[model samples]
Target: MTVVTPVAARVTEGRSLTWRVSLSEAADADMSTMFVVVPATAPGLSTKDVPARWPRDTAGAKPDPERPLSKVDGLYLFVDVPAGRTSADVTLPTLGDRVAEPAEPVRFRQTDMDTGEPLPDGLVLSGSVLDAS
Candidate 1:
């Protein structure tokens, strides 16, 4: 059961947010990769905005513009985790200027790379609310 907790419950627009990923237990040998999902409706957010430390998985990282909004619920940002690490830090890219005040809380959850399913225990207890100044 892995859990991802945002360092801050809220962040100013145009700023980056950091999240802490804690493994309930030591990372499994087969658990080599993970991903975070952000709402597609998030303004100016994209897979290309992810930090370099967490390289995007070319295979599934690309979002289809033609996909229906109903079907496209969120965007995927992939990350590689070294084995046995108990925890890791993920810093999201800066919010774009287009972000509006009182923007929706940016929720995040860790998911399985292959399954594209949220980890059994990787639900986001709280999302980082965006404040436009």
Candidate 2:
């Protein structure tokens, strides 16, 4: 099972969602794995943005220029976490600010990198748009 938690309410704001993520266990399924999913209905968020520094290795290796995070199911952003890594500070790209509306919370799910399995209930990360600009 995987666990996802928001470090703070303000996880930085830009063209996408940038925040730190901690994994109870490393996800070592394959070269390409699905670590998280941000739904389109996640309240004012878009998954069309290009992912930044994706396909990264937690050991400080350069990001894989070939592999990148992309939209799936038309609206969900499937984030890829490196295999064999337990934690990372991740920055996922988005077309618009995740917090398009004030005070509303943006939500995301932690999933098995390879199987696309969501974590158990009550393990999602959520926060408001502290800095939409």
TM-score of each: 0.56, 0.42
**Which segments of candidate 1 are over 4 A away from where they belong?**
25-30, 36-74, 96-100, 119-121
Per-residue lDDT over 19-87 for candidate 1, one digit per residue giving the tens place of the 0 to 100 score: 676777776663544454544345423432333233223334234342321233434444444577777
The lDDT values for all models are: 0.51, 0.44
Q: For every model in order, what is the number of clashing pairs?
A: 0, 1
lDDT of 2 by residue, 11-130 (tens): 444444555555667877523323344442434332223333332322222323322222332122344457787665544443344444453345556555555666565345555444
lDDT of 2 at 53: 33
Candidate 2 lowest-lDDT run of ten: 66-75
Quick one: best TM-score, which candidate?
Answer: 1
Residue 54 of model 2 has an lDDT of 35
